[model samples]
Target: MTPRDLLRSAGRNTFRRPLRAFLTIVAIAIGAFTFTVTSGLGTGINTYIDSQTRAVGASRTVQVTGTSVMSFLNERMEVYRDDMDTARGMDVGSGILGEEDLQRITSALGPDDEYSANRQVSALYYSHDGGQRYRFVYNGYWPGKTANLVAGDQLRDDTDQAQLIVPSYATRPLGFASAQDAVGRTVEIGVLGQDGEVRTVPGTVVGVQEKSLIGGNLPFGNQVLDDALQDASWAGSAEDDAQWYSSVLVTGEDPDRISRDVAAQGYATATAEQTVGDYKSIVNGILLLLNLLAGVAIVAAMFGIVNTLMMSIQERTRQIGMFRALGMGRRRVFSSVALEAALLGVIGSVVAVALGVLAGRLLGPMALDLAGLDLPGLELFAFDATSLVAIVLGVTVAALVAALPPALRAARMDPMDALRENR
Candidate 1:
């Protein structure tokens, strides 16, 4: 028989036992469905992580902090009590970067390198239209980091006045209809003094950003605002001794090399890509376990394929003999059985992918809601085309391989002996 005829016969033979074929297809579909959903979950989480990492300037920059002499001791108790007492009275910025350390980091940069200092803001308070007020922790840094802007413009370095960038999540809570409405509005931030006093500082709303995965509840400000808040917070305290920075942000053409150099200078360095890589590794590890569980289901389905094809071969012994008697080659007979198995696999995989995608779309938001996470622009389940293709091809190949033994047995049947068997 021609190849086309053989394929047509194989396709028809797949459903010869309708009930058995249906059960086998369902088994395979179970595996495909699990794999697709789990893979999509991993992809969604990693995509969110990558976006947040980029937003925090992790990719092209490294955070540098001064190394402490406490590292020389094996245990915290090993430090002298006198030293602990001294540390209690020291400023919050003690052991962090100072003017000399900042200069050293700046001098180590290449001609194209840029650096900025981050300072801790004591507290941030916001009120609107004489409504109830709210307070939270805030951080100050240079503007120019790419962010998911919802309205207005990013804080510019040239801006001399204090400005604030609110997160979209705070829009309604802060009494704004939308992010656009929040822009250009004046807001009061209560900067806490070292003596536990709340001092109000005026700041103009320049922009609003979507809530970030990594940044959490901490709001951001420009250097101008940060410096102003720092000065105000230090008022009535010892502000003239020496200024210390929380951390130094360094960006260059070669972030990895810069990180290493910064580490060599007795500073702890954290690169954005490193943090993202660690998160990716964790996500991949979890997905691997999930995929393996799905693989177990698929493997069970493969055994079903083997059993179904073997039974079919036994029942069709006479038919095989008749086909051989008609001068069909052994290889063609083998191809026909293998093709039948592949057809079943294709049907199962197609239906499974459709159902899986539908389920993912439906369940993604529900899962997020159940978990109590209100992340904006994050879909808990997202399909990747490459992953879908791989899953289909892999399952089909597995089914074909499972049919090999049955195909071989049919191919080796003698024409005269098989024709004599009872039908």
Candidate 2:
């Protein structure tokens, strides 16, 4: 028979036992869909992580603060089993990485090395509309990046104390709806400075950023870009408030190599890739467990296909004997059974993929509610080209595996005995 005829025969036989075919298809679809969705989530996670790493503009970053006088690290180490545990119990003290220490670290670096320091402080925003408050605000501060500079100039070292670069959120009360319009205007920055004084500083907006990153060690909330020079001024003014040096950023193509070399210079380093990888691993582990559970549904469906095929073989004993007497090879008989299984797999995969795409679209908007996070660009289910290819491969593999035993049994039937018994 021609290949087209064989295919037609396969399709016809697949539905001979409709329930069994349906079950087999369901199994294949479940397996394929799980594989596709898990892989897609992993990809999205890694992409999101890398974007965060780039936002920091550093392959490696180190945070060195003053060692506390009370020997908290030592006390924690004595009480805890490991460095990680000790870190959890410890709090930073002065002299770890002050201006003088930063200068010293910079001096120690090779001529090729360059670094920048950032000041980190937490404060609550007082957003009031005639005594009606919407929400309390938390945000981060950054230096700048070449990618996201939408308007005006980036935070420069020579900026006066009165100038600031506020995040887009800061402009809500001022009647500006967009980040672009917020730049070049003035905003209020409130904080309890060093000493027992509460201070609110007014500064000019220098720039606006397009992307809002919320991953890695970079930042946890909305962010504003500020000049490094201004950071020093804030720290100096609020000495008692103690704005810690968040990071000393270092850049190089290969962060692992750069971090190791930097460590030898008496300064610690953490590669952005390494940090991001750790975060991805945590997310991947969760997805794996969830996908595995989804896969169980597919396994149950496969049993239905097997039962259907076995019944078909029994009912067609007389037909099988006739085909054998007509000189059809055992291999052809096996091919017929296997082809049916394959067709079922193909149909199931197609249906599942279409379903997955629809699910992603419907669930994308609910990402915020499900995840308890307002991820700006998140989709609950994403149907990507790579995922589609993976689904097809998974379905094909399942079909071949499920077909092998049944095909062999059907091919090995005793033709003469089957014909006599049928009569």
Please name the candidate that would achieve the greatest lDDT relative to the true structure: 1
Candidate 2 Cα deviation (angstroms), residue 351: 1.1
lDDT of 2 by residue, 54-95 (tens): 544434443333332223453221222332221211234322
Note the Cα lDDT for every prediction shown. 0.77, 0.55
Clashing pairs in 2: 65-96, 66-94, 66-95, 66-96, 194-238, 194-240, 194-241
For model 1, the stretches where C-alpha displacement exceeds 4 angstroms are: 51-54, 66-95, 98-107, 124-131, 175-178, 194-198, 236-243, 264-267, 365-373, 416-420
State the lDDT at 153 in candidate 1.
82
TM-score, per-candidate, Cα-based: 0.83, 0.72
Q: For residues 118-150, write the lDDT of model 1, one tens digit per residue.
A: 644565576666666788666457335656787
lDDT of 2 at 290: 65
Residue pair clashes in candidate 1: 58-272
Error of 2 at 397 (Å): 1.1
